[model samples]
Target: MKIINYREVPILRQSESPAAGKIWSAEGSISQRRHRQTRNGDIDMAVGDSLSMDEYKLTLASPAKVVPLDPNLVLPKPTPDIETAKADLKRAGYAILTDVFPEELVRTARQVLADEIKREEAIDESRVAKFFVDPDAKNRRLNRLPDRHEVFRQVLEHPVVLELTKHILGPTVLDESYLVHSVDANVTRPGSGAQFIHLDASNGVGHATPNQSRFIWCLDEFAEENGATRVVPGSHLWNPEIDPTGATTYESVPAEAPAGSLIIYTDMLLHGTGANISENRERASINFGITTPWCRPSINFPLVLDPEVMKNTSQTLRQLLGYSSVMNGGDYPWESAPESIRSLCVPAKMAY
Candidate 1:
C-alpha cells in the first residue's frame, strides 16, 4: 500500500548528525550547506563537562513518522492493458470509445430523444424550457430516462460500458461497485452559449478521489461549432485547492467525435458544454454515469421508475437501480415484507 504524509505530520529533517547538515556533491565531497547554516547563525552547539565527562546537546529534532495514505483519499490507477482507452484514461482522465454504439441504435435513440422532447414541451413549456435554458434559448436537457424508454436500458447494460465501468470503479462492492448515478441527455442547439466548467465528483474539493464516472453516448456528431464538450486535459490529477471554474488560465479543448462514439471520463476532470455558433447543427448526447455503491445516487430510481418498466428489466439493471446485493450495507433487504420485488435482490453478504 502506498503511504503519504497526513495533514498533522510536521516536516522534519532526516538526521541529527554533523554530516546530516552537509550537502553532498556528485563527486561525494561536501558542498557549503553546513557553512551557509553556520554563517546564518541558525544553529548553536552546547557542550557540558562534569569531572572529565562530556556531553553534546543537539539542535535538530527527531524525524516524524509518515502516515499511511487514507484508503478513501487514494485514487486507484487504471490497470494497464492492450486497450488504448485505458491508457488514454490514465494519461488524460478521459477517453473516446470509437464505434461503441451502432448506426441503427444511434438513429433510434435520436428519434426517441426528439419525440420525448416534443412530448415534454407539449406537456409543460415553462418547465421544459427552463431545463433547456443553459442561459440561452433552444437548448434543453432530458431527465429520468430509464423509465421513459427501453433503448436507454439497453444503453445502460452495454457490455463495453459494464466492462470499462468495472475497470474504472473496482468490481468488488467493498470499496467500489457500479450504481447508476443518473441517466440524462443534453441538447445543445445553435446559438446556445457555453455552460460553466464544473466537476461531477461529490464534494470534489475535500474528497478528491474519483468515486464516479460518466459515459456520454453521442446521438449526433459533436463538433466545435455545434457545442462539443470542452475538457481540461490532465485536470483530474490537479490539487483540490485549485479551482478551475473561476480561473481563466486553464486551457480546455473540444472533444469532437462522430455520432456513435462514447466519451468516457472520470467525474473529477474539469469540463463544460461548448458554445454552439453554427447555423443549424444541434448537438445531442445521452449523459449517463455510475457512482460507487456507497455514494448516494443523484436520482432515486426506485421512487421515480414506473412499475411497468421494472417488470421486464434485467436483474443486473435492477441491481444498478439500487436493488439487491450488499456492499457497505444492502440497499433494499430481501428479508423485508415485500415478496413481489424479491426477484430484484440477490443473496446478500455484508462487506467486512
Candidate 2:
C-alpha cells in the first residue's frame, strides 16, 4: 500500500553489493530496515533496505517509466546466418552475440546509465500499474522507457534476434517487440529478484492454443551470482502443472552469458531470475515477445508504438509484433466465403 519512486527502492546497501568475480546466494527475503526522519523531512535508510512509505507495503522509486530504446541509433552486428542462429537457439533457450553492437554504442549507453546513477535523476518513484504489476510483490514489475530511443529499438529489432524468431516461428514472422521490463542496479536487491518457478502463461491462461515465443536481451553480462535468469531445459514440453515432488526433477539452470546475448524460448518454458547476491553491480535486460497471429501478446505492443514506428519497422519485425493476421487451411490468393458473410467477418492472416 506504500507509494514510492521505482529507482530508490533500496534493495542493496553500498557495502553489501556483490563484487564482479563471484557467485552468491540472493534467495530469501531480507528484512526491511527502519527509516529515520531528519528535521528537514528527509528519510535515511541504507541501501538494500526496503523503503516502505507505509507499513505492509513497499515502494520502488525508479528513475524513469519503462519505454523501448530506439533501434536506429545503434544496431547490432550482422548475426550468424539464419541456420546457425536457429541451431543455437534450439539447443539453448538463448544465444550470445559478443561484440554485437558497435563497441562505441554499447559504451555510450552504459555511460549514460552510469551518469544517471551519479546524478540520481533517473530514479522513478511511481507505483506500478495494475496490468503489469504482480499481486505478489515477490514478482513486481520494474519501470523501463519504451519511446523511440535508438538503442532500445535496435535491440528490439536486432537482426540476429529476428532471424532466429523467423526460424522458430517461420519466414513471415512479425515484430511483436516491446519493453517487457528493465532493472536498475541501485533498485534491485537480493531476494527481491524474480525467483518464482513458473511460466509466463501462469499469470493468465491464453486461448489454450500454443503460438507465443519470448526473446530476452542481455544489455549487460548476466552471471549466476548477479541474478542471471535461470531456466529449466525442455520444461516447455511438460504439462502446465508439474507436481512439487517432480519440481526438483526439473533442474533449474542459469542462463549465464555475456552482454548482447539473446535468449529465445517458448511460452511453456519454466524460467525466473536468480537471486542478486552481488552487492556491487546491477543486472539489466530487455525482454521482447512474438506470437502467432491467432494468439494474444503478453504485453500490448501495438498500444505502445505509434504507426510511424510500426511502418518503419521491417516486415519480419512487424509480423513478430502481432500486426498481421493469420490465415489457415492454405487459403491463398482468394476467399470463397459468401459476400454477406465475408462482409461481416474479416479474414485471419497466418504468420508463417
Candidate 3:
C-alpha cells in the first residue's frame, strides 16, 4: 500500500482532488490505485471546458431574483438552547447562535488572520484572490486555517459545535467514524461580491448525500446591508427534480448574527456568501467543513500538521485530523486496531 502525503498536494484539478487513501482512477478503462490505503471517491466540479465553465457559478444571475432577509432566519438564536435553532435547521436548513463565543476568542482569531495577511503582504502576494483556486475570482479567503494557527484548534471540537456535527454528520459508512473535510476562513473585503448558493459536498455537480456540514464562526457582525450569508430555509429538503444543475432561483434569506455567533448548516442546505457592501468594513469569519469519514479534505491534516503541533494536540483533534484511523477511516473495529494509530487514539483493550 502506498501512503499518501497531504502537505505537498500538487495543483492537479480545481474540482477533483483525490481522497487520502486507496482509490479507483478510471482513465480509458485502465484501473490504477490512487493511494496506498486511506479512503476512496471521486468529486469533480468543473463540468465543462474553458468556454462552458458554468458549474460552480450558481450565484444569483438575475438581479430581479434578489435575496430577502427574514429576521427569524437571520437572527442569532443562541445555542446550548438549540431547540429553536434545531427546528430552524430542520425547516430552514440553517441555524445561528448569537454571541456564542467570548469576545477575546473572536479578537484573537482576527488577529491571527491579520498577522497572516501581513506576512503575505511582505511577499507582495496578499491579494484575496490569491487564496482562491480560481485566480480569476480574487476575494479575501484562506484555504487551510488549521495548518496556520492553533487559535482555531479549540473550535475543532467546541461542545456546541460537536453536538451540531454529530446531530447532522452522524455516523458515516463506518460505524462511529467521522472526519473533517476542512477548516478554513472567509475574510472578505469591503467590495467583495457574493457567490452562487452552493453545497459543501464534493466539488461534483448533482444531488449529494447530506453528509457534509459547515459551521461559520462570525468574527464580525453579519448585517443585512453587508455580506451576511444567504440561505433558502427549506431548500435542504428540496426534491432532486427542482434543479439538478445545482443552480438556484429560489429566493434566499440572510443569516444576520453577532460577531461571536456561530452559523451551522447542513451540506445539503443551499447557502452562499453575500457581497460585502459595507464601504470600508471587512467581514471576517472562520468556516469549518465537517464531512463523512470517506471524503478527502481540501487541506490534508496529516500532511500539513506541524510535528510539534501534533505532539501537543488533543486526541480528539488528532482523530479528526485522520491520525487515529487504522485503515480507511477506521474500517476495522476498535478491538482489531492497527498499531499505526495507537499513538493517536487510546485503544480499548479488545473492547469498545
Weakest ten-residue segment in model 3 by summed lDDT:
1-10
Tens digits of lDDT, candidate 2, 40-85: 4322221111222232122222112221222232211224345554
TM-score of each: 0.71, 0.54, 0.70
In model 1, the number of clashes is 1
Report the Cα lDDT for residue 315, model 2: 48
lDDT of 3 by residue, 1-352 (tens): 1111111111122244466555322222111211111143211121111212222332212222222334354433556457777777877778887656788988999899878866766766655454533312435666556667877888876777777777776654445445678877776677655554555655433454576778999988887556777666666666353343422244555677878888988777666676566788777788887776667666666666665556777766766766655344343333454333334453211111
Q: Write the per-residue lDDT of candidate 1 for residues 1-352, one digit (tens) a residue.
A: 2111111111112334585674312111132111112233222111111111111111222213221222333232222232777777877778887767778999999999989988988998664564522544568888878888888889988888888887787755553336789889899999776654457775555466687878889888888789888766676777464342221224456777788888888887766777777999999999988888777888977667765668887767876776655565545565763555655554333221
Pairwise TM-score winner, candidates 2 and 3: 3
Candidate 1 collision pairs? 132-140
Best by lDDT: 1
- Give candidate 3 regions above 4 Å deviation: 1-80, 124-128, 131-138, 172-175, 203-209, 242-248, 326-352
- Report the error of model 3 at residue 245, Å: 2.9
lDDT score, candidate 1:
0.63
